[model samples]
Structure formats: C-alpha cells, structure tokens
Target: MQDDLVRRAVEDGDQDAIRAFLADICSLTDMGFAAVARVTEDRWIACQVLDKIEFGLTPGGELAVATTICNEIREHGHAVVFDDASAEPDWRTHPIPILYGFKSYASFPIFLSNGDFYGTLCAIDPARRRIATPQVIATLRAYAAQIATLLEVRSPPTA
Candidate 1:
C-alpha cells in the first residue's frame, strides 16, 4: 500500500542514522518527543519516533491530518516554533498546543532534493523550553536537511 511505501522510504535508509537524528534532536532540544512524520494532503504518518515521555506513537502510527500543526507546515512550507505556547497570544487560541499539553514545540519542513515536500522533523515537550534560539533552530534545520537527503537517496527517481 502507499502507507507502507512511505514507511519503507524512511526505514529502508540508514535507519540507525534516522534514529540518531531523532535522539539527538530530542536531547539537544531537551524535549520528550521527537519524530519524522510523513505529512501528505490527507494523512500524517509517523515514519520514526523517539518518545521519552510516552506520547504513545510509534513508526507507522497515524495522527489525524487536520489536527496537527505539521499539516499547516505542509501548506505554508515554514517552520513552527515556540518556547511557551501558553505565553504566545497566537498559540493561546491555537488548539494543538492546548490539546496536546505541550508548551514547547517545533516542526521544520523537510524538502527532498527534488523539491518535493516530504514531511517534518519535529519535537514537543510538556514543559517550557528554550528551543526558539537561533542556534537551536539552525541545528534543527540542519537535521531536517539531512533527513531529506537520506530519504532522497533511497527514493526512486522521478519520471
């Protein structure tokens, strides 16, 4: 099925590297959860995850596309980041942070080398975190780029 292909695209690559990227991002950002999810027009599928806080999702798990901020990232093609969602006037009304109970969050778009929007490298935590700094953003962007590259390498060539 299409879902299986997406999952294999990530798992078929250097899975150890993907795992390391998620682990490093979680540690570097001091977040409890990190994942690379495939966000398409109608679905949000978890390709990989590092869940220290037991958010309870694993590879192949699906989240409703409309409920995730990553869906917005897919639409706007930009990163969404915040240190304290409750403190942000915009996020105060945004339901995702409140619904997920995550005060700190970040999601960066991963564009494949062919310019296709792949998905995202994202992290979240229940506590406030200093993850909005330039350094942290840069690191995350780097990781997203790396993941994109990895996926592209394993993907079939476009006709």
Candidate 2:
C-alpha cells in the first residue's frame, strides 16, 4: 500500500514543485536533508529527498516505521521538532536521534485533501538548528498542504 503511494508521489506530475519545496526548505532551515516520506502502518519510504549531508537515503528508500518520528507525527497529528537532540534532556536518549546521529530534526505530517493521511515532510541535520517557531511551523504546514493537494489532484482516493 505504501509502495503504491510512494510510487505515485515520486512520479506525480508536480514532482518538480515538490522537489523545489524540499530544496527551499533545506535552504531556509539550514537543514542538510529534507524528504517527503510515505508513512504506512509499519513502514516509512522516501518518496522525495533533498540530501546535502549525505544521510544516504534515496527516493524509494525504506526505513522501519518504528525507527522514525514520522510515525509518531502521523499518529498524533503534530509536528515533532528538536532544536538539538543532543542538548535536549528529554530527547537526548531518544532512539531516533541516537540511531540516526542527528542533533536537530523536525517532521510535519502530510494529509490528502480528503483528510486521508499521506506521509510527512521531514528534515534533519547534524548541527543544532533552531526551528519550531511559529513562522517555521506555518511554512512547513503550508508546504505539506501544497504537497497534499498535488497528490490529491494527481490521484484521489479510490472510491
């Protein structure tokens, strides 16, 4: 199921727009990596990525759902953000950061226009990057909405 959605998102007509969004986000947030992932009940797949720090995941690449915070964001419908995972007393020992070796991270869930959960727009960097500000969250939310709109227009949920 997720494989199909990943394929659709990767091949969607507005892929260029999504790529531009990823690039813009990476640039604005000083993030080394940005990605649009297809999150399912048990898996996470990268449908698009802008990787500048060699995080090593490519389009269609897979990661365990349990290993990514996107899963939590998906379930909770809230963005999970960390300015510095290494400096955050509560999250310093969180498995995602420790396993991925990232000092900063953020993830916003994507949703289709019809209210179906799609995936996530996520970024991570080795250096601590300050985000989670209102402006930043608003920007990420807008981008995620645009991506969702593109997906819905390209492939509406099956009736």
Candidate 3:
C-alpha cells in the first residue's frame, strides 16, 4: 500500500503515535480533515491523515505543492488560520479554497529540530467555523513541535 511507503518515509520509529497525534488534532480542533504532509519544493504527499468529511485523500495522496495552501506555509514558515474563507474578503476568491471546497482551513509549518522545513500539519472543514481560537492555535503549534520531535527521533539530518 502507498501508506506503507509514506509511513516508512516519515516513521522509522513510532507510527501509531504519529497517527494518534493527527487524530488528536482533528478532535481538538473540531476539524473534519487533518493531515501531516511531507512537502518538498515540488511535491506534497500526505504522510498521515484523519479525514472524516470525505475529502478523498489517503495517507499517500499527493496534491500539487504549488496549488496547496501548505505550500504557502512551507515557503513562509508560518501558520495560517482561516475561520471561513467565504467570509474573508482576502480569501473569497483565493484559488485554493475554491479549488478544494473548504471554507475553514488552517495549516502550520512542520520543521525539523535542525530548523529545516519538513512539511505541514493542516486541517480543513467545509462548514464555516471558528478555528482561530487561542487554544486551538496553541494545540496545533504544539503538535507541529511534536511532529518535528518524531522526525528527529526517526532520523536526524546529517550535518
């Protein structure tokens, strides 16, 4: 299965823990979709996912890196939170939300312990809901740190 390949790429240590972390993200945020993606300049592959809203992406699903909001997080090394794209003047015509059919979305850049960009921890929902709460953002940032820790534990980058 492709998930096997994806899992091996990110997890040389604990797989269940990472999956549970993603699940915890969705549960805590009330998001229908949560994913840990492995991102590069040219690719965005889902390494783990908790998709309850039928977003149709699996563990190994690939989306164009350039087209996804995760790419923005990757490039800027920042987290984005959109409570409702449809309500925001800046996001109303944004291609990503329109293309993906998600009204509420958030993404945080996942970095390695060595400060290298790894990917993103992102969640989305179709309903227009509040997701920019302090508690949710704090939890998501913590999850990003935890994912980085797992990556480091799996295999630290060579100096």
Candidate 4:
C-alpha cells in the first residue's frame, strides 16, 4: 500500500502528494514544508521540495538551505530543529535565514539501508515556528523513514 503511494508520487512528480501521504500516516506536523536532499562528497544537492503553502524565498534559496541542512545532518547524523533562529545563540549570527529570508527549520538525516548517510528530509518555515510535541517529532521521523526508503530504492546498487 505504501509502495503504491510512493510509486504514484514518483510517477506523478507530485512532491506534495508524497509529503502529504507521509504526513497523513504520521499526522500533519510542522506547518507542512518538507524536502529531500541528496548528499555528495562535501556537499548536498536539493532534489525535491514539498509544501502545502508558499513563502518569500526563491527556489534557489530553498535549494541552498536544503544543501546546508543536508551537510549539517551528515555531520550530526540526527534530527534537528531551529525553533527560533534569532534566539539560538549558535545560529543567531548565521546569515542563512537573513540572507535567504527563511527563519525556522527542522531536518533529519536520511540514511541508506546500509547505514550510509545519504542526505536529509526537512521542513522549513519563513516564520519562527516551533515543533514542540513528541507526536510532531515522531511524524517527522516517520516521514524521514519514507524518504530514506525512496532514496534507497532510487539509488543504484553498489557492488
């Protein structure tokens, strides 16, 4: 059933359908912007961006943040959320949002079945939004899992 949904999403080039399907199973969480990025040596490539709403940044800015988050996730190997970038000491001076017009973000690393860190699945908002519930986190994690599965299936097998 899930595979069918995923296949349909891929076939239709429907990023929102993919994200919404995952969110429905997990419960809609975090204002509904999700993306999938592909990690390469020393950098990440933004592959897909899914959103139920629109924001001010251009596609380029979105791609840039996706790449940045992918790199960060590769280094950290976990889920992260910047609820209030302005309040976060570590990120207060980070020119990402100010430069790109994005303010809030949540992301998780997508790992291949072999445990290789491939990239990340993320949600971003131009407003300072908080994902403060365990359910929300769980939902994001589940969506990340689905993304990982998709990546694994799409990637050529390494022999």
Candidate 5:
C-alpha cells in the first residue's frame, strides 16, 4: 500500500507525462533503461520505467534494495554517475554493475518539498556510454526537480 502511494505520487496521475519524461531522459543520456524507483529502507519499487534494451523491469516491479546503488544515493543524497563502470577504478569491481551487466550508470536523488527523500531517477546501459558530462548531469538534476514538484503538488495533504 505504501509503495503504491509512492508510485502514484511519482506518476502524479499522469502516465503519459511520466512515460514521455522517462523517454526523454533515456534519449538524453543515451541509456537503454531509465527508471524512477521508490526506495525505502527495505525495498526498491519501480514507479516508472523506459526500457529500450528489454532489461525486463516494469512499473511496480521490485528489486532488492540491498542490490541497488540507489540505496547509497538514498543514504547520502548524492548523484552517482560513471561513464564506464568497468573502466572506473572505484566501480570496476563493484558488484552492482557486474550483477546487472550494465556498463554505464547514473542516478540522481529525488526529494520532496518537505525535504524528505523520495527515491531516485536512474539510468543504465549495457554498453559503455558517455553519460557523465556536465550537460547530462544538469539535465538529470532538472528532471529530478521537476518530478519532485509534480509529486509535491499531487500529494495528499497531511492530517
């Protein structure tokens, strides 16, 4: 139920908009998969996904929170980006990429207006791609903020 709410919030009652936004993100970053995932301490639920490479996850699909790098983004509220995980010293041996078979990865934190961590806007590609450019990072940040604003506006008021 909680995950459903978060997914709805991320969708903001507009499936077309969310889909288009994610498609744009994939195009912008040259990634085959892009998703907005609702991450909690124990779970990672996909809210929206654009899967060009048939990576096999759809909206509402769940992944073990422990297996995702987004969990770390949730911990520190920072964006993680790598042009080629297999070539980057820090991520070359990291298990997530190896486990997922993705060469390029990027994830940006999404926070609500009240400063609560919501989840992440992340993308991945099986082939190494240049995704860590300043322009791409800035665009991802802007998209994240846009998502946050939509969620904030659509969220139900607190009791």
Candidate 6:
C-alpha cells in the first residue's frame, strides 16, 4: 500500500512524490511547507524540500538548521509545528529560520527500526501557519517513517 509507493519513490529518488504525499496529506488537514532532512552523527542534511524552502552556508560556513534540529531531535525526538518564532521560546534566538525566510515550522525525528536516528522530516512556511489538528501531525509522522526507511536502505553497510 503506502509502503510500496514510498519504496518506489525512494528507488526513483522521486522527491516530488514525497513532497506531494506530504502536501496532499497536509492539505486535508491544512498544513503547509512539508520537507525532509537527513541527519548524520555530527550534522543534519537538508535532502528534500516540499515547499517554500531555502538553505545555504551560514556566515560561519556550516550547515544551517542541521545543528539546531539535530540537538532538538536528540533531546525531544520531535518538534511540533509552531505558528511563529515568538511562540518558540528557545528558537526565538536561533538564526537558522530567520536568516532563511522560514517563519513557522514542524519536524519529526527520523529513526531506524534499530533505534538509530538519521535526521528529520519537517514542514516550514514563510508566514505563521496554524496546525491544530492531530491528523496533520499523524501525517507528518507517517512521512517521517518513510524517510527513516529510505535512510536505512540507502546508508552504507557497517562493518
């Protein structure tokens, strides 16, 4: 069913299908700006964008959003959508979103079946987008599960 579709998407590197899947699910629940990122031990990788996305080197020449999301996922496992930067106490001072034109965001940690975290599946928007429905969160979680599976299959085998 959904797993087969997602597996085909992964095999084809069909980012748009992944994005469309998120968008369709979100549209049903009125969420916006869905995206996915990969995390390594030391950094998060921005692998796919669903909408209104932007990223580049910071003034310090490091991967933007990687550090912040990695830390949060490590600490909390997932981040619920926030309407605005003002609504987020800790992220209010973080430059990643502000510098990159993101005003609202949500992200879920991508974890393998064996419990290794690989990155995140997220949504972002330039304006405050309200996400009050549990269904929307559930949709995001489903996408995150697909992302984790993709990472597991794609990652190099360990010795």
User: Which is the leading candidate under lDDT?
Assistant: 1
Candidate 1 accuracy as lDDT = 0.87
Clashing pairs in 5: none
> Which sections of candidate 1 miss by over 4 Å?
1-14, 157-159
Error of 3 at 23 (Å): 1.6
In model 3, which regions exceed 4 Å deviation? Answer: 1-14
lDDT string for model 5 (66-146, tens) is: 999999999999999999998999999999999999999999999887788888989999999898999999999999888
Report the Cα lDDT for residue 71, model 6: 55
Task: Single out the weakest 10-residue window by summed lDDT for candidate 2.
Answer: 5-14
The number of the candidate with the highest TM-score is 1
Compared with the true structure, all predictions reach lDDT values of 0.87, 0.85, 0.84, 0.60, 0.85, 0.58
Candidate 2 lDDT tens digits, 1-159? 445756765665348888899999998899999998988888788888999999998887888899999998889988888789988887898888999999989889898766778899999999999876888888988988898887677778654
| lDDT for predicted candidate 4 compared with the true structure | 0.60
Ranking by lDDT: 1, 5, 2, 3, 4, 6
How far off is residue 67 in model 6, in Å? 4.8
Worst 10 residues of 6 by lDDT: 53-62
Candidate 6 regions exceeding 4 Å error are: 1-17, 25-32, 53-62, 65-67, 153-159
Window of ten residues with lowest summed lDDT in model 3: 5-14
TM-score of model number 5 = 0.91
Cα-based lDDT at residue 119, candidate 2: 90
**Residue pairs in clash, model 1:** none
lDDT of 1 by residue, 43-74 (tens): 88888889998998888788898999999999
Q: Per-residue alpha-carbon lDDT of model 6 for 92-136, expressed as tens digits?
A: 777766765666777788777887765666666677776545866
Per-candidate alpha-carbon RMSD to the true structure = 1.8, 2.2, 2.3, 6.5, 2.3, 7.3
What ranges in model 4 sit over 4 Å off? 1-27, 30-32, 51-67, 156-159
Please identify which of the two predictions, 1 or 3, would achieve the higher TM-score against the true structure.
1
* Colliding residue pairs in candidate 6: 39-118
lDDT tens string, model 4, 1-159? 334433432333235545454455323554546666655454444455555556432221324433365666677798887776778887777766566456677778877777887667777666777664687778778877776676556553354
